[model samples]
Target chain A: MARASGEAVLTRAVRILAVFEPDRAEAGVAEIARLTGLHIATTSRLVAQLVELGLLSRLPSGRVGVGMRLWELGQRASPTLSLREAAMPFLEDLHAAIGHHVQLGVLDGTEVIFLERLSAPGSVVNFTRIAGRLPLHASSSGLVLLAHGSHDLQERVLASPLERLTPATVTDPRELRSLLARVRRDGVVITEGHIHPEATGAATPVRDRHGTVVAALGAVLPNDGRAGGVVAALRAAAHGIARAHTARTSDSH
Target chain B: MARASGEAVLTRAVRILAVFEPDRAEAGVAEIARLTGLHIATTSRLVAQLVELGLLSRLPSGRVGVGMRLWELGQRASPTLSLREAAMPFLEDLHAAIGHHVQLGVLDGTEVIFLERLSAPGSVVNFTRIAGRLPLHASSSGLVLLAHGSHDLQERVLASPLERLTPATVTDPRELRSLLARVRRDGVVITEGHIHPEATGAATPVRDRHGTVVAALGAVLPNDGRAGGVVAALRAAAHGIARAHTARTSDSH
Candidate 1:
């Protein structure tokens, strides 16, 4: 195969894998090929290779799904696991103290994939699920990630479609630009625009040893406009997580 | 390359990936070659290809580590994420109700690899880490998994070396046989071996729709003989997790 053809095959493989989301975990090869816009033969061959490599497994019913080996490899390779593990205690503290929905997310591509979430009983019905993705311009974690993200990433996101998630969402690129600027300047985001009208979120960046913002720690509270204390708690939690990360790094050495 | 050579290369790649752990995250090509008994030239070529494929990444300091792409793909391709997501709420409930270390583990080979754990403030210090492995004949989760595992797996584990972690660990194959029988009959395991002397763990199996034990949920309590309630909580949590798993599978259809 040509270099471009090999790259195309790899991209198709990724696309096939991407089709297996929280809603769709198992699919036939024809379904994958149709979803990925690839030839059925190519999809079948690639899926077979993946199964042979233990990246995918075939069920007893002959449907293909993501395999346990893939999960083991992913769990072992994920940097988010370390960060989430370190933040769990503090997140639990904040969740208990504030009695809201606490979340930890990391930037993956242009989206925020939630790593962990703790919800209080009778909290607002939040749609954010663990391992679920949200746009980088909608949620509070997305705002922190966008604010701390690279200039190129910011420009790319600004140029792309900014779908309106709610009536309060800032979909205009110019307004979003200004909002991201304010987030960078203020070091926090309090937004009611992401998914629910009755919920507001406060997010702050969790920095690594090199001072790079690696993740966002945030909490979702009811939109009663009493978010100042929540913001302070989130910032403190982020700081605690960062300190724990540093300590763990040093301790492991 | 010949077919056998291709298989060797693939196996070598897996070995290279296996060498990287939370403790040893980065290594040089020479170290990988030395560890896996592969030629330096072959190791270099394979590592370079893996880097190109985004399965491994080269650091600025001239060492290589598992890549973010691998992490992303792994996260995207694992059933473990779905399992963890379904189990987290009940795990949290158990942690709060028991105020001890709550763990979820799955049988991997003859060992049990912890998938998730929730610890309360001032919980007993245990060796269970995410992705960490423990022997099948030792810990409570291990005993549950081994007891419910396939006969082939049970025999293999029985034949393998059961390294004694503590003086209380059951290393005798004959005693282990009877203990596994008891665990199978009782549907739970309470073990004081393979970890701290001051901690005792009670574990129960979480079964899927096919009635196969897919995972184990356990709680580690301080060995002050106040473990009856904790064991009940663990069993209840395991049942809750199994119900959640069934609901998720049904909802996916």
Candidate 2:
């Protein structure tokens, strides 16, 4: 097939990869073609080339999955290394205290991409995994981060449709704005039954030395109708991570 | 400037990224060009494209480092996701008890690439990092994995040049062979001063339900002449992770 340039092919390859989600780990050629909006033949050819280079692995049934080499390279030089490293100790402490799912999330474009997650074996039912993404209106971490996000980002998100995961999720822009206002004023967010009917989310903003909100540290707990010191724990951990990150930033300089 | 295909460009991008070490986060265009064996102009062009794609970021001094987007994508669809997830809780327990540098490593070809690490603030001086690589003969995790690795793979490493990192590092093939044999027999490896003079590493193999060696669970401790129950802790944790991974594997099916 004729193409524009090498760069265009690379971009197409990236788009093809973007089709696979956290839940869908493997995909057949036809499914990939349909999802990526590329011709099946082109998709097949690209998948072959990527598999050849170990950027993707072929399953026994010939479907493709993300390659270990790709993951290795990503880990080798990830930009979020500093923040993830800084928050990990605190995430551990929080997970120990809460005995639930503790997550560290950062604002990635318009989504809150979880950087790290510490989970207990039989804790709250949280579908959030490391590197998982959640909408700005359906998670407490998202709300805390979005509250401190840029004005343009806020307006852009408010302009878009907010999908609801549960009936308790705030989908109305006006209501979401008010919720964000509360998060900004209170320095923490407690969203009940947002992602799951039985779970509640609490999050606090993590900041840098200059007091710039860098990430949201959060935990998913049983919706027992009480904050149960989770707010205090998250805020304290956020503060600890912020101070650590700030010190690390200064050390790097 | 010219190239073979778009795939070649992706290959070149990976090569450029391969120049960075965990200790060295950022590099100048000239250094990257020299290390990647590409013309400076071509290297600059590729760097610009990568930066635009958010796979690499530019530093204040015009150097480039790994980008956050690249890291996020890597984590989102990594091959080691399940193993890392399954081992996290047990790794935390081991870390809490020992309070050193607890790491999870998987064998990638002849190298042991760390998948996750939990480090205490003033723990041992460990060179191993999350996503960092260690030679198959230079770390305890590497030794444990190599001990259980395929015969062909083991032969290949033993036949190659065995680089020495410290005085205690066994470079003689016969000695290494014996050491590996001991690891296999004892079900663990304790490497003293292999990576550093002051650090001792202990590691054990973690197997999946199908009895495949999936990962190495290990820790770096002070080389203070006593294993100090660290070995027991690691083995217990490794056993726990293996069972957890097996359960997850069964559940997924």
lDDT of 1 at B201: 81
lDDT of 2 by residue, A19-107 (tens): 66667888999999999899898888889888877778898988889887778777876767888898888888988987888999989
Q: Comparing to the true complex, what docking class would candidate 1 get?
A: acceptable
What does DockQ give for each predicted structure? 0.40, 0.64
Q: Is the docking of candidate 2 incorrect, acceptable, medium or high quality?
A: medium
Per residue, candidate 1 scores C-alpha lDDT tens digits across A37-142 of 9889878877887777777788888989886666666567565667887888888788878988999999878999888888755787677877777899999999
User: Lowest summed lDDT over 10 consecutive residues: which window, candidate 2 chain B?
Assistant: B1-10
User: What local lDDT score does residue B229 receive in model 2, on the 0 to 100 scale?
Assistant: 72
The backbone clash count of each candidate, in order, is: 0, 0
Off by over 4 Å in 2: A1-4, A59-61, B1-3, B19-21, B27-31, B57-64
Best-fitting candidate, scored by DockQ: 2
Clashing pairs in 1: none
Give lDDT per model, in order: 0.81, 0.86
**lDDT at position B25, candidate 2:** 83
